[model samples]
Every structure is written in structure tokens, then in C-alpha cells.
Target: MTTTLRDAHGEALSTTDRSALAAYDHALDLFNGFRMDPVAVLAPVLERDPGFVSGQLLMAGMLLGSFDGQLFGMAKACVDAAAASLQKANERERSLLAAFGAWSNGDALRANQLLGRHLIDHPRDLLALQLAHLGDLFLGHSFMLRDRVARSLARWNADDKGYGYVLGMHAFGLEECNEYARAESVGRRACELQPHDSWAVHAVAHVCEMQGRVDDGIRWLKSTQRHWATDCGMAVHNHWHLALMQMASGDMDAALKLYDEAVAPAPEAIALNLNDASALLWRFQLRGVDVSGRWKALAARWRLQAAWGCSAFNDVHAVMALAAAGDEDASRAGMAAIAEAARLHGAHAWAVALPAGHGLQAFLAGQYARCAELLLPLLAASSPLGGSHAQRDLLHLTAIEAASRAGDRALVRAMGDERAARRLVGARPARTEDHVAA
Candidate 1:
């Protein structure tokens, strides 16, 4: 029932095999799931034809919906390819695409670096304006995200329905900084604007997770997974978050299974990072799992800080890896390296906190004394670490666990009692044991 192009005679030139069908299906699944790796997933088809508008839009949606660390190089490559194709995408489409690309690969500084000069020529150019706002948001500069969106909305509010996209994107950033009130308010607006909007829905999940509504967040994800199982981006990311939330809630069995089913099959970095990958090292430490040679592949991946590396947010795991390999010297040296990188880059977009890294190193080194001393200050400062309250909370909790190990009374109280207590929304008990769950 399959057909193939042939030469002048009628010989078969190529085959429409099952693999091709599966690849196309996979592409569609990626898109529907909200995984956001358009450049990576769609690269094959894209390389075959540059002016693939559908591919561009799919890629754009992935980029726009991005809530994790920036996929800078992949985005840049896609944008450059699309531009080279000269397909002349519409202004709104082009602007948002370029904005995500710059934000991802180029960084806020790079985006600002270009926007400053571009604004002089096209001051009110909506694309440039939107991107300027995005740069401001990430760089923690003075640019107003809502104000810019308001302007854009005023122009297209009536006819355009995608404004939810803008609001949802901003909501994710706000949630990252633990600005729950503002994030929730913005998220409500986004949801009202587009209830079915994947990004808007995802932003709300960030808020829920920050508020320690892990069950609610995971429930939402399960519902979303069912809704977007055919959707690639959403499926992978939703599974990633759900797995982490489960782990945090002490459902290790569920977490591990999800990791294998959802994360192992996917390439997102955060999935591995948040899911207690230290278990891999710990298993090796106990001589239970033969994870010795696993280091070469994983370390190589982490060293580049590429896709898998983004989730390498847990510096402790890195330390554990070095220590597990019988190289305490290597572990110390690696910490110094990451410490410098954190200072230089300042994990504003996707990293946890600098002190969290130090705290992780202490725990990895078994220097409970120093770990408590360093991380107590860190737990106090987690609110300002950026990204979202839940992430900061996780950082604090992780530190507190280390501090508790360090026998630091203050650190334990700060992370365990005070921190958890503050996360209470109602008359609920503060001691949820999320932090102390062995």
C-alpha cells in the first residue's frame, strides 16, 4: 500500500518505511506534549528543507513555552536556518521566535546588547520591545514585562488570543523568584485569557509547586499528561516535574519508575537532576550497582552543561561522583570550577543558588561542620536566589538536610521548621517532613 518515487522507468527510488512514519509521529508527539526541544527534535526535517513554516511555528511554540534553562545553541541554529531560508515569517511570529532564540542562546546580556542598538532604529518595533522586556526580566534589570505586554495587548487585545502566551511566560519567571502573589495573579490572568494554553497551565504548576502543593501540582501534571500524551514537549517536561515532586514527597518508588518511563526515554536535564541521581552514585558507593564506567558518559555530558547538564543543578551529585570514583581531590577541584562558573553566570534563569552548590559540596565531602556553617546563610537567602519559590525552597530544604546532617541546630530549624512553616497557606501543620524524608 506504500508508494515510492522512481526513475524515468518506474523503479523504486525511495521507500516510505515504518521508520519514516514513526519519525513523523514522534515529531507530532513532541509538539503535542510541550517538550520544547523543537530545534533538536525537528532538526532532521528542518535540515532537509529550511522554509518549513509548520516546523518554524512548532519550534517557536517550544521556545516560547520554555520554562527551564535556555536551549541557546539549538534555538540559535534553528533561527539562523529559518532566516537563511528567506521564508519571510510574519512580524509577530518572527519577533517571538527571535526573542526566544536570543534569550536562550544569547542570554539576557546578549539580548540587551542587541536590543539597545535595535531600539534606536525601531523604537516601537513590537518584537524588539518584547525581547527588551524579556532581557530585563532575566537580567533583573528595570524593564517592565507587564507594561510591555499591556502595550501589545492594547493593540491586539480584541483580535489576538495569544496574549496568554506572554503573560504565562512572565508568570514562570515570577514564580521562579518565589513571587507567588504576583505570579499567581498573573497566572490567573493568563489562564483566564486561555485556559487550555499549555504554557499558561505550566506556569500555574510552577506556582503550585512553589506553594508546596506537591499533590496538587502532580495531579495537574497527571491530568495534563493524559491530555498531552501525544504532545512531546509537555509530556516529557510534565513527567520531569511530576517525578521530582514525587521524590520530594518521599514517593521514591513512583519517582524511580517515572524516571525510567518518562525521563530515561527523554533528554531533558532537569529530570535527571531533581530525581535524586545521587542514588546512582549512592548505589555505586554501596557497591550495589556497577556504575563505575557510567561516569565517563555522564561526566562528559555534565561537563559540557548542555541538555543533560542543565539539570546538573545539584552540584552535590557532581561532588559525589568524583568522591565515588575515589577522587576526593577531583571532587574539590570540580567544586572550585563550578563555584567560579556560578559567580560568573549567576544562575538567574535556571540554576538553584550558589550557596546551595557549596552546601552540596560540603555534604558530598562529609564535612557536616562546614556544610552547616555555609548553608545556614544560604537557606536564609534562598528567597532571593531567583527562578521560583519552590526551587529556592528545594535549595533550602536540600541544604537543611545537609545542615541537619552537620548537626547545626539553627540550619535544621531554619530549613525544617521555619521554612516549612512559612510555606503553610492555611492551618496546615508546618512539619510536612518533605525535608527530613530520608
Candidate 2:
């Protein structure tokens, strides 16, 4: 007779092997904390028990969340493997497998909707909630980011094992939706509950960055370095935030030092890490900093990912590196690829990817008027590009810089006014050096 095992939330696990269940719980803990690589942690367990559907689904959700096109095949295989165990899985597992299947099939919208429905039935499913929250993040659905967690909050309390993680997610959502004060409060509470929660630390960092608290942002991240900087998967990004604060403080030397020691240090093939490198270097480019060697090295790594056109956000960043390095042929090739991807993928590719890519191209080529023309229109509707508001601010920063270089003072002032309006009342005013420091 098979014994029923339940996860931390009391949800039934399909496997009777207590060891597999424990491994699954451990992997879930790693994933929730953004610490170790959960996929690696579960690989051996899945090899030992092929019928562990929950483990398979967890792996699939993680791979899908990576946003790396190279991992899509693995994600699909995980979905297929889980489907083979469908006869043993509960309804919740089946729903999760179906959602992963949709994501692997390139229907992220469908996958998110499926997860939303699954949550309605199983609000205590922390794994499902995490996958759904990530889907909202990748889809740039700000309201859903806040509301998805909001809808499930009543089912969770401080005593729940992953309650702090849930608050961390909600805090990020609130920040994205521009509720800075509440986001900071909730995020700090999450850190207090789980001191090593890097996501919670990141959420509060974002709040500080957005509110123009450069000194406070630096202090917050530095004070919490012990929690997030050691063996944490998100360390590079957190370092990138610190570098951004240094940039805001007009210490380009400090920012460059952070880039060399903390942010990149070496070329990375991962799209997520590459995005951070390119965004940081591109900021230097906008400031007329001489980092051509860094650009060339970063562009070389980006060239290895030439086949990854699934994410428009990634494609635009690739264009940034290639263009800044003065690799005209590669830059043109990157733009053409975006155009082809747009033609194949429709509205999002066309509206977000193509313009973003070409706008960066123009900006790098000193065609400032053309760059502003291409990117300014995207300011209001670039969420479809898929990234946090802070990440997407690259486009806004570029547009403002382009307008300034083109002698469009009205456009510059208008963009500045828009930025100032979004900032909290006590935040620093938009400085000329922030955008036009040459």
C-alpha cells in the first residue's frame, strides 16, 4: 500500500518515498530563498524516483522562469516527464504540469492564467504561487504581481514556513506599482522574519533605488551584505543595484570598481547576468565614459547567445553591447534579428523589441534625433518587454539622453518632469548630470 505524503503546506505529494518528499521540501526551500541551484538539488532524487511528479514540476517551473531559451528544451522534457506520471498525480499537480506545458509551448499568457486558476483552488500551494508570481513578473503584469500574492495572503500567516517569502514577493509587487513606502515596510518585515531572504533584501533595495535614496540604498545593501552576498544566486543583481546607487551619486569610479569586482568580474553566458552587465556598461556609455574594452568583451559573450531571440528584453540588451563596442556588422545583425523576431512573433516583438533594438543602435551611432524618435514613444507602453520597472528604466534613460543630445530641450524637460512626478516627495530632484553628463 502506498502512503500519502504531504508537503510543508499540507498539500499531498504523489510519492510514497519519504526521502523523495524530504528532498522535494529541501529543493523548495532552496528555490524559495534563491540560494542554491534547486534543479541540481533535485536531479539525483528524480533519478532515484521517476514518479516524483512534484519534483518534476518544480524543476520545470524553475527552468521556465530562467528566461534562457537554451533551457526551454529541458523545461519541455520536465513537462513531458511529469505528464507520464499523470495517473499518480493529484489535480493540483496535473494543473501545474499543464501550466508548465503551456509555458514550454511559448504561451506564457496561457500558462499564467492556468496558474491563476490553480491558485484559486490551491492557495496554499507555495510553489504554484511562486511560479505564478514569476510569470506575472516576466509578463510585466504589475497589478497581478501585487494582487496574485494579495489574493493568497489570507491563507498564509507568520507561522507558515514560506510566509516571509510571500511577503517579499508582495513587497516587490507593491514597489513596481509605485507604492514605495508600503513596499519598504513590508520588505523590511520580511527580512526581519527571514534574515537570509535575498529576495526580501532585493525588494527593499529596489524601493531605495526608486526613491532616489542613493546613500540609503548603498547603506542598506552594504549592511545586509552578509545575508545576500555569500552563496546567493542573486548576488550579481544586488551588486548591480549598489553600482547603480554609486552611479546616481556621480561616483563613476566607484561604479566601475563595483562592475569589475562584484557585478561582472568576468564574462557570463547567462542572459540574466549578461543583461546586468550590458545595462551597467550602457549607462557608462550614456555618460560618455571610456569603457570600450569592457563593451567589446561583453559583446563577445553576448554573441554566443545569437540564437536566443525569444526574449525581446534580452535582445535589446544584446544590441546595446554590440553597438557600444562599435561592432557595426554585429549591431546590424542584431537589429535584423529583432526585426525578424518581430515579424514572426507579432505585436510584442514589433512594438517593444524592434524599437528598443534600433533605438539603441541609433543612440550608439550618434543619431540622437532618430534614437529619441524611436524610444520616446515606448516610454508609456514598454511593459510588454518583460522586466522590472527599474530594468526597463534603461529605455527611459536612453530616450532622455537622446533628446538632450539632439538639442530637444522641451523633450528633455518633459521627460525630466515625468520622472520627477513619479519620484516620492522627498526624493532628490532630477539632476542634469543624471542623463546629460558628458
Candidate 3:
């Protein structure tokens, strides 16, 4: 008689070693909490149980999800290794491996479709649910972000191991879809259930930011600092959110302090971290702040990632860093990379991001009218370029600033009025605070 192996969620495991499955479960918990690198946690386990298909898939999925083209080789290796063990994999495991392979090969659409189908069949698969939710997020499929988690909610309950993380994912989706009130409620509940869920903390921060609740956003992030600020992979980003709130409240000094201390304290090769750094610095530039030294340092880090044009979002930020640093040649090279990426990945979001990149360049060059012209048409279509609404607001902000600099007050006012209307809808009054202890 053979004993079946099951995970914490009662999902069957391919590996017979209960200890390996426990390690895998621990990795998933770390990932769900956004506390540490799950790949690091799974490395030794996979070495011991080379046939652990789910572990291999999780590693591959995380590497591909990093959006670092340099990691594609490593992700491909994981895919190849998983394929070798496919004979031992269960149905859900096979589907997950296939999805990871698709993502590694740059077929995100196919990958997402496979993950979605896998989730439908195995709704209890938290790993699949997370990968699919992140896919929706990277593709800017806001509806799917909300609905994907919603679809699996029936299969989950309070007693489920990763229920709070699911709610965190849903909260971000709702916030992306402009359901601010519900997003905040769900996000808050998620945090209550799992205090250390940084993604949930970040989701509520998004709600406050989008609704212009700067004070509330500051308070929310500051109050939750203990949960997310230490050992959480998303610390920089949550701090980025706090810095944005500080900027909105006319506290540029405080924002810069956060930038120097928390947001981009050092150069990192990670595209996501670099994106937050570049975006925050660019916001400072838009306000006529002197960030030249900072830009020079940031541009150096971005130079390390210049060859990886797999992500349009990352490419745009690279352009910002190079251009702001007065590296004209490197800036031009970054633009060429964007063009090349757009030409090759026409079906992807790169094409949508090309104009935005050019518009940002124009804004930097003092070609205000041209900047507005290039960016205004892209405001509505920018979602496919992959980022949250708050992140994409950089484009809108540049356009409005350009119109103002071009002496087009009417255009600026119209754009500002439109933005104000959207932000003010269903917005509650922000409670006053003496100071943000960020």
C-alpha cells in the first residue's frame, strides 16, 4: 500500500517526501506574505527532491515574473528541468509547468490562459492563483485581477491557509478597476487577517493614493510600517507610496528624505526596484527639484539592465534615468531599445509604451508642446503597458505639466479638471494628522 502525499491545502504533491512538501509549503507561505524570496527557500529542497515538479514550477514562475531578461536563461533551465520530471507530475503540476514554460518563452498570453484554466480545475492551488493574479496585473487586465480571485473565492474560506493573500490580490484588482471603497475594505480585512501581508498593506495604500487621500495614505502606511517595512520584499514600493503621499501633501523635503533613506537608498539591478526609483525621481524632476546627482547614480544601475528590453515598463524607467543624468547617448540607446522591443513584440504592450517613452523624453528636453501631443493620446491606452494606475499617472502628469509650460492653460485646466473629477469620486475627507512618522 502506498501513502499519498498532500500539501497544507490538501492538494496532492508529486514528491513522496513529506519533509520536502513541508519545505515547499513554507516557501509558499513566504511568497504569500511577500516576506522573502521563495526561490531561495526552495533551492535546497529542489536539490534534494529533484523530481519536485511544483517546486521547479514555482522557481520558474518567480524568475519569469521578475521581468528581468537576464534571468530568462535561469528560468529556462528550471522549465527544462521540470520537463524532465513531467512523467512524475500530476495534472495540475503539469499544467503549471506548461504555463511557466510559456511565460519563460515570452508567450504571456498563452501562459495566462493556461494558468487560468489550471485555476478553474484546481481552485485550491494557491500557487497557481498567485501566478495568474500577477499575470493579470502585469498584463493590466484589471477586470481579471478582481474576477480571477473572485472566481476562486467560493473554493476558499477564512480557515484556508492563504485566504488573506487572496483577498490582498482582490483588493489590488478592485483598486485598479476604480472600486476604491470596496478595495479599501477588502484590503483592510486582509491586513487584519494577516498582519504581515505587505501586498495587502500596499493595496490599501493604492486606494488612498488614487482617491487623493494623502493624509490617510500616509497614516495607513506609517501605522503598518512594522508589518511591511522589515523583511518584506515590497518595502521599497510601500515606502515609495508613502513618499508619493508626502509629495502630494507639499512635503518635498520629507519625500526626498524618504527617497534617500528608503526608496532608492542604493542601486539595485532589479527592474521593479529600479522602476520605483526612476519614477519617484522623475516626479521630483517634474516639480523642478534638483536630483541630478541622484539621477547620475541611478543611471549607472539602470545601465546594467539596459540590455533587457523584455519589459516596456522597465525600458521607460531606464530612459528616465539615462536622460535625467544627461547621458544623451545612453538615453538615445534606451529609446532605440524601446523601438526595437516594440517592433518585435507588436502583439505585446511594448508598442503602447513607445509613445509614452518618447513623450517623457520630450518633456525632459523642454519640448513641452511635443510632449503633450505625444502623451495625451496615450493616456487611455497606457494600461496595456503594465503598471498600476498610480504608476501610469506619471504620463498624465507629464502631459499636464507640458501643456502648462507651453502656455496652454486651457488644456492644462481641462486635463486637471478631468483628473480631479476621477479622483474626487467617492472620496472621503482625509483625517488630519500632525505628522507622518515615516
Give TM per candidate: 0.61, 0.94, 0.94
Taking the tens digit of each residue's C-alpha lDDT, what string does model 2 give over 1-438?
245799988777888888888888888888888886777789999898777898989888888887777788888998999999888888778889888999998788899999999999998888888889887887778889899999998999899999999999999999999899999999999999998889889899999888888889999999999988867778888999988888888788998998988777354336778888999988887777888999988888888865456677778888888888888888889888888878887886346889888888888788999999999889889898888888888888888778888888788878868866666211122344444343
Clashes of each: 16, 0, 0
CA lDDT of each prediction against the hidden true structure: 0.50, 0.83, 0.82
Candidate 3 TM-score, true structure as reference: 0.94
Task: Identify the runs in model 1 with alpha carbons over 4 angstroms from their true place.
Answer: 1-37, 40-107, 112-159, 173-196, 247-250, 265-333, 339-355, 380-386, 424-438
The TM-score, computed over Cα atoms with residue i paired to residue i, of candidate 1 is 0.61
The alpha-carbon deviation from the true structure for residue 4 of candidate 3, after best TM-score superposition, in angstroms, is 4.5
- Decreasing lDDT order of the candidates: 2, 3, 1
lDDT of 1: 0.50
Sliding window of 10 residues with minimal summed lDDT for model 3:
429-438
| Candidate 3 segments exceeding 4 Å error | 1-4, 265-269, 424-438
State in Å the error of residue 123, model 1: 11
Native-to-model Cα distance after best TM-score fit, residue 121 in candidate 2, in Å: 1.2
RMSD of 1: 10.1
RMSD of 3: 4.6
